[model samples]
Target: MDSSDFTCVDVRRDGFVLHVVLDNPRSDMNAIDRAMHDDLTKLFRMLKQESQARVVLLSGRGRAFSVGGDFEWFRTLRSPHALAELNRDAKQLIWDMLDVEIPIVTAVHGYAMGLGTSIALYSDVIFMAESAKIADPHVKAGIVAGDGGVVAWPMAVGPARAKEFLMTGDALTAAAAERLGLVNHVVPDAELEERALAFARRLAEGAPMAVRFTKMAVNKLVKQALGVAFDASTGYELLTFMSEDHVEAVDAFLEKRQPRFTGR
Candidate 1:
């Protein structure tokens, strides 16, 4: 397949392993968009065929892991239909990540914010860089973190901490993330990729059927909970986009200043 097929993800074969890198080479911060969401669908569909694909590694080139949704795209979605379509696409993208039978290891470095944090959470194992800053700042953008944040955070950490982080949109250091069980391990930036690959290879060596079944069994409860919450919160998140707070948040981001959000 041509590399150009995916604008947000880089696909490659690495000796029985399929390496998918999130490479927006020109953009230091790769942001999620419609194209990326479509790319994710294609990538996961292809993954189903690669039975030999024992492990999948997700990473990003340049400074950031991801910066979440694209600003231009968000600005374009003003109407109810556009917003609903956007949410539907996004929900499918996240579902693909959650349902991928193969093991995934996200090697995160530098900044991982907004949907970036959701991407990491979807992975079976997330290895973070010592200097990485991870946060779900969707609320800062005036959207409820209805995706993986609401579905996964409380399960990963405690509900109290999840509330604090999701509500405040505060960034967490790698060390703090480790304490909260947000990531599997923290490595020096230089060793982040190496460690993640090593761990993935270890899982790959195990019995595939047993591993897949075990994963599904363990996640049954989580799957049920996510199904209910993701549906309900989808509307809540889209409603926020219609509010003035979302407009102000986007404006502040463009203006390069703090947003003074009023609970309107």
Candidate 2:
């Protein structure tokens, strides 16, 4: 495995399968920071160049899969321009994850919140632990659910459920999410990775063209139904990053307290 400043992303190959683990540790959950984002972008680019890579299994290294955007990373940015750049970086990461050509399966456990939830949702298939919690808490942080939520949620679970989740900033249990069609399956925590890898290997063993084409066909339909909403989400999320409320939200989270947002 190679290393970067954000060695948070660890990549390894076994036969035809690529195993990628998110390894950030500041939070029990691996919250995405700029460095980690860059690493993931690089990882995907490498994957895109690999004609022999048949499957990808994405998982987190710690107790929680991911807790979303890094609070400390947000706290360090004080300018509208800087915030916009950060948002774009994050948006691009999600878009790459969605548009990548290979068959990808995500194994989620513990917390999958904010952008983390979006990552899981965008995967070709998601296997989550029953103990996992997935939430789009961007509204709670005074930002739009821009990263993956608005682009993917309504398509996966219907517009009404999408509205409720984004509006309320509530966490959904893995079982609830599966029942609502947001996740593919919910298994025991111990079984999450095993199940996901097994599924990925199965896909990898199949005819590559058939699997890739089927995934592409379905994704095209989703993108068409969703229109250019992803572009809109990118703009809105960056705009919110310019807000005083956004900074305050990050500060509050880092300080371990409720944010007293002034809606600036």
Candidate 3:
């Protein structure tokens, strides 16, 4: 994919490794707006056809890995058509991320929240910075933790623990994330990117077909879960996006006040 093709993401090649950076146009937290979301859904599909990049190294170009859906985008979602499209895109994005055969190593810096947390955990290997954290704050915004949160979190941290954090929208520190199997390793902030790259390089240097097939073999588990839950989870999430409580939460967020959800 041409670097310019994806306005919100930057892509560069380093040997057989493709470096994909999440650089949100509006903010460093790399919030997901429609453009970013579309680019992401297209990314893995683009990579799947390529023989050049044996491995993908993903990271954010800012203080936070990502913070989730953009507030401005949230304010514009008054139309059912837009919501329906976004819901499908959300499902497509996760499936594509899982469908790719090349190994993906994610470098997590700062906080990875909502879709941020989903992408991070979906990576084949995750290297988190010591001070970084991960969470799905969708519920805090009065929405279901749709996307891959329902699938990946339970697989990583076990169902009981995943429910605790996902339901509460709580954050897990990098160390805690590693302990809970949500992340593979937690390195010092200074070494985070380099360590993640090293791992990607190792995968890139391996016999290409062997690495790709091995990745695909392991992803069967994830695909199985998606088959069972993706449609329902994203469906429910889109419904929540239309709720009065979701509107109040967004309003309260902008006004910097506690949300008064009347359970409508």
Candidate 4:
């Protein structure tokens, strides 16, 4: 409830809408690091207890909604203990987001990649900027699209289209994403925040119990999908964390070069 309780994420209240900003100071691009990841998990869990909050408007503070996972943090997952913690946190974050009864409206801009894309996809409504791009580029990092990506993308765009983008780690423009039904709306980059916030405020002003129950009912389908696939996908992703190819991919990403994967 209190913004002071979090370090990486910024939380504030505007009337009945809770404004949650992904503002990781460690990355100008707002990449999800360990701190941000943990903060998000805690934030969503706390949302359930906030009596005054009726809706959540989630966005980013920098040039990006998020550029996916921090490669520096990825390096730390090489250890078994770290990977186990990641697996737990990844699943908990997605589950908590789904469990929260409040409707979440996301305003995505710049780049929303990997976990970032997953977060946006899970929201009840998504508003993407015209110049912004979205992608689940876990494959490019030599990892599985396990953290909500596997569950959300296929549901949004269908399995065939999802597989194409997920496997190739291809980026989709706002228009393309809209065409695929991946996002609810696309606005000019400048108007992204205003439009998304307006919609969130509208949701907030609606009949509270009716809105909350509607969201809860709709999320049953998502929760079913999460139950069916999330654990297995994340488990596979953790296995990939120990792969030689994952090591090369992270190395190349940081070194600014193409990874030479040997399928190890």
Candidate 5:
């Protein structure tokens, strides 16, 4: 993959590990917009096909890993064309990440919300900062967590617990995440990147074919679960993107007030 294809992500290599860092253009949260989603899909697809790296370390550039969708771009997504395009990219994002043959280690600090949480949790291993948080806030936004949460959350944290958080859009602190088995390790905020890179380097040093194939076999479960939930979830998300409650929610959010749902 030509690094030129990415405008918002900083891609670099450390030995056999590839690092992709999110450079948030619109906000401190590294929010996902259609363009970022499209770029990420392209990156993951390219990684699936031609990455020579044995491991990947995914992280964000600044304070937050990502805090979900960019509200400005989000406000324009009510159109069918916009929603449909994003829906397709959402599915491809999940599919291509799963298809990538190498193992991925996520170093998450700050908030990982919605698409951010989806991306982090789907990785092979997650190293989160003790002060960081992970959540899928689509429900709070009055939409489905269809970016990949319906599959990734349940697989990592189990269905019963998944429902509690996903249904409420509540955050799980990194410490809590580790306790719940959602994150592989939790470290001090300052050590987050170092630990993740160290772990990725360790993975890179392992017997190459065996480690990659092990990742493949383990991810087969993710692929199987995703096949069952992804289509319906994303479709339902698109449907809700145009809902009365969703509009009300966005309006209320912009107005800095609570939404009154009429259930239209």
Candidate 6:
């Protein structure tokens, strides 16, 4: 796969492990704009054909893994055509990630919010920095936790706990996330990359077929869950794009004020 095709994500192969970085040059926080979203979907599809890649180490550059959707980008989605494209890409990204047979190990530092949290949670294993945090704050933006949040969170921390965080759009510290069974491990901020790389290398060095098949077998259950919840949740999310409240939320966010939602 030619990494040059991606402007939002940086892809580099290190031996048997493919290192994928969520580095959006347009945004210092690594926000997911249209380009990043499409790049991610394409990247995963390419991974399926990467014969040399046995494992993937996914991370972010700069201050965050990702801070979720670019608020500026969110404004453009109010149009029906733009929203329709977003819906298609959103579903495709989740499905492609799940379909890829290679094991993905995510190293999350700083903030991973909204779609960012969903991406990390979908990984086969997660290594989070002790000072970092995760949150699916779609509700905060007056949107549904569609994407992968509805599917991944409930499976990770159970329905009750998932509902609490999802509905409130609250952030969870790495320690708290670890206790809730959301993350696989929590290392110090300084050790996060090294520890995660070691783990990915371990997977890469393992018997290739065994590792791939094991991941495939386990992901069947996730695919089943996605079939049940993903489309409906994404549909509802798209509906919110047309809501008055969603516009207010986006406007208020950009203006840096509390949104006054009237439940339109």
Question: Could you give the candidate ranking by lDDT, starting with the highest?
Answer: 6, 4, 3, 5, 1, 2
**lDDT minimum window of 10 residues, candidate 4:** 43-52
Model 6 — which ten-residue stretch has the worst lDDT? Answer: 41-50
- If both were scored by lDDT, which would come out higher, candidate 1 or candidate 6? 6
Q: What is the TM-score of each candidate against the true structure?
A: 0.94, 0.92, 0.98, 0.98, 0.96, 0.98
The per-model lDDT (C-alpha) reads: 0.82, 0.81, 0.89, 0.92, 0.87, 0.92
Backbone clash total, candidate 6: 0
Model 6: per-residue Cα lDDT over 217-263, one tens digit each:
99999999999999999899999878888899999999999999999
Residue range 76-184, candidate 4, lDDT tens digits:
8898998898888878888888888889999999999998898899999999999999999999999898998988999998999999999999999999999999999
Per-residue accuracy of model 5 over 196-235 as CA lDDT, tens digit each: 9999999999998898899899989889998899898998
Worst 10 residues of 1 by lDDT: 41-50
Error of 1 at 92 (Å): 1.0
Model 6 stretches astray by more than 4 angstroms: none
Runs of candidate 2 with Cα error greater than 4 angstroms are: 1-6, 225-227
Supply candidate 1's per-residue lDDT for 30. Answer: 73
Predicted structure 6, TM vs. truth: 0.98
Please state the error at residue 37 of candidate 5 in Å. Answer: 1.3
Model 3 lDDT vs. the true structure? 0.89
- Candidate 1, TM-score vs. the true structure? 0.94
Model 3, 1-264: lDDT tens digits are 758879888999998999999998788789899889888988877877777889999999887889888877887875799888888788888888888888999999998999989998888999999999889989988889888899899999899999999899989899899998888999999999899999999989999899889889989988998889888888888888899999999999989999998876
